[model samples]
Target: MGFTNENAGYIAAQTAKRFLDAGYSVRGTVRKLASARPLLEDGLKEYSQAGKFEVVEVPDITVDGAFDEAVKDVTAIAHMASPVSFFFKDPEPVLHAAINGTKTILNSALKAGPQLQTVVYTSSITAVKSAKEPHYVYDESDWNDYAEKEVERLGKDTPGPIIYSASKVAAEKAFWAFREEKKPSFTMTAINPVFVIGPPLIAPKTESAVGETIRLIWTVFSGAPFPLPVNGFNFTVDVRDVAALMLYIASSAAGGPQAIADILRKELPETRGRIAEGNPGKGYNKEYTVPDGEIDINSEKGKALLGGWIPYEKSVVDTAKSFVGLV
Candidate 1:
């Protein structure tokens, strides 16, 4: 089941379509029918055109019995539903939702037992890399140590944006711990992506994190208020590519959790550059500014395991041009 109608939802729908096209039945779960209408319509349309797609309404993760009904008879599960927010004053909501939501999904999978053969958990690069460190590059092995401290310091006197990095780290640790203890019958994989950018399945008007980022880039290029942060650098990945990888991981016989992480790192740099270049209407400052911190991802393991999922070389420029209505 995928969460809200954002990047994860878009990617999940695309992955479901591929499965449907491949002659497999696909089921998607969302919190509400109203909010999920766009995805439902898109899925229904795809199924109407070709393939089998079904969207089921599931209770919010915060509620009890939410996962019970969602996981019934499912052969595999993609646990991507988690609380995602750009800014937060309280960490409790985000942290509770993320941590508890993961537990709920995993618990459901555990209950499903042998019926669930594969489970893919969507994680973030925030869980792996520290923003405080000046490391030029990072790999899957690195964990973000500075996120919590920064959040605490920034929010010392007042409510501040909850550190997503800290929440991710805690959630991931919980997931691994659950996996080790319960020893579920299914194969588990986690895909950690950096800044995800691509053509929206909906449009530029939608209020999404990626959309907002795109809008910011637009403002920057259009010569609007351009207070570009010089202290933020991150890797990027196309949503389409991420969706393809998720599907591949779901279906691949040889690939597993570690393999997924490896691929992400190996492809990080190329992906980042592509997403940045894909910003449409490019007329902003030409100066390549670096943030106060550096985030590097190494995906060598992914390449080695997945037989080299090469990132498109023109991804950056192409993405920028496409975003700017040039493509």
Candidate 2:
């Protein structure tokens, strides 16, 4: 089962299409059968006449044994069903969900380790570093300093967004711990995407990274209540690229976690961008630039293994057009 959103779902759909085209049976897991029906119907209509798309309902990730029955008979699993939200009054729920969900999935994978050859966990750049430091650059090696985060929480001033970053850090740390202790037989890989944006496979109603990006663009151009962050920038990759990378890792005989990190390093530069397409509002003199002193994730290792990392410039343009109804 995979998480579906405008950005991620589009990529997931594309991935599913590729697999189905190769004549592999595809089953998608959804939290709600009713909400996922549209995606299922569309997949059936677009991908195949054989109705190979199957949807299995799973318990909430926060609950134990949520994936017990779901993982049965599955050769490989891509754990992508985690919380991705920035608007939270409290971080406890989001943090618990992310950490607990990962634990649940990893535990289940360990139980199914004998049959499973590989499992790809979808992580994020949020886990790698934070945008708080204006002059600091971040790369794959730079882990977010959660210790500093705790200090901030105790300080007089604390921003809610920091909670999101903290959650990612904790979850990633938990993942590594689980890996080290249990050392499951199956190979594990994690894909950490920056600001993932692309075309939507399911459409606007779906809450996805793609949809959220479009909403941000609309807020910028339409002169909404909130203004775009002038100093805010994100590393991005095309949903297609991410999906392809995930599939490659899952299917490849040689690729591993290090290989995935290598790919990310080579691809980071082309991915950084401002939240909006055009210039900032008046008096917003500061423009977002790639921070210096941060670790560069695009390394020779990534370049050698993943070939060339391609940026999705067209995907960005297409995303803008979709929001403006020009697509």
Candidate 3:
């Protein structure tokens, strides 16, 4: 489920593909039925023809009972609908939308009752990291409560990045709190990813974060000044891997590490770079380092829940290849 046709296509299309491959029918929600082109792309049309895929229109996700009908017979929910662009002038609306939209879905799920087993929400690394202070390492236990307070202090004037980070924090915090308060029968899990980058299922016409990230690398190939951030590196994950993780969690049994009902971290790469090494302005900006401890990709939990990490290098290559002529 997503706001625009293109915004959620990358992960949504991939998630549907994973389920279709496993012989499970999918009922996805879209804001506008007319704009849902990505889901019908590739061989999904065949799945639709076979009656394995269907989409219901849910124009407003923040409204109560928005997903009541969508969840009627479905066994699971992948609540991926959230704002991506941080260009909004005011933070309150974004915060409200994030918190309220999540509540609306969970409420509908509760109304749907026992059939719904799990809900895998797409969270972000923003929910875990402290925007003001740098940490040596971060894990599932970390929460971005500081960022939420920062947003409250600054209100509408909060920076786009801060508001965007706080939105995730607020939404995820609301989810856990709702689970504790409501104690609904279904299990809930969050896949907290950082700067998702990979080949989109369908290449987008307008430049998006995924498109722009791939374009940044193209600048290096053309010998343009590719400004590699000198301060800190963002942890990155392949979109495919994140979608697969969602599927694994949604379909897996109710026990093991997932039984604890906590947020699961996506695998991280060792380093980050877009352009050539030793560029003129590489080390000039000394903001602070964003620390990440190594994720045990081979650990029992990871091995059991996710198809192992897709290397960032491959993600970069595939992203570049996907936009070969368009970019």
Considering only N, C-alpha and C atoms within 3 Å, which residue pairs clash in candidate 2? 137-294, 262-302, 265-297, 265-298, 266-298
Residues 76-173, model 3: lDDT tens digits: 88888887665666887788788888999888988876667888788776787664443344556667777778888988788887888889988998
Which ranking of candidates, highest TM-score first? 3, 2, 1
| lDDT values for all models | 0.55, 0.54, 0.62
Q: Give the winner by TM-score.
A: 3
TM-score of 3: 0.78
Rank order (by lDDT, best first): 3, 1, 2
Q: Candidate 2, overall lDDT?
A: 0.54
Clash total of candidate 1: 21
User: How close is every model to the real structure, measured as TM-score?
Assistant: 0.72, 0.72, 0.78
Better of 2 and 3 by lDDT: 3
Specify the highest-lDDT model's number: 3
Model 2 misplacement above 4 A: 1-23, 47-51, 131-137, 151-158, 205-210, 219-226, 230-232, 247-306, 310-312, 324-327
Each prediction's RMSD over C-alphas, in Å, is 8.6, 8.7, 8.9
Clash totals, every prediction: 21, 5, 0
User: Where is model 3 more than 4 Å wrong at Cα?
Assistant: 1-7, 41-43, 131-135, 206-224, 247-304
Output the lDDT of residue 192, model 1. 75
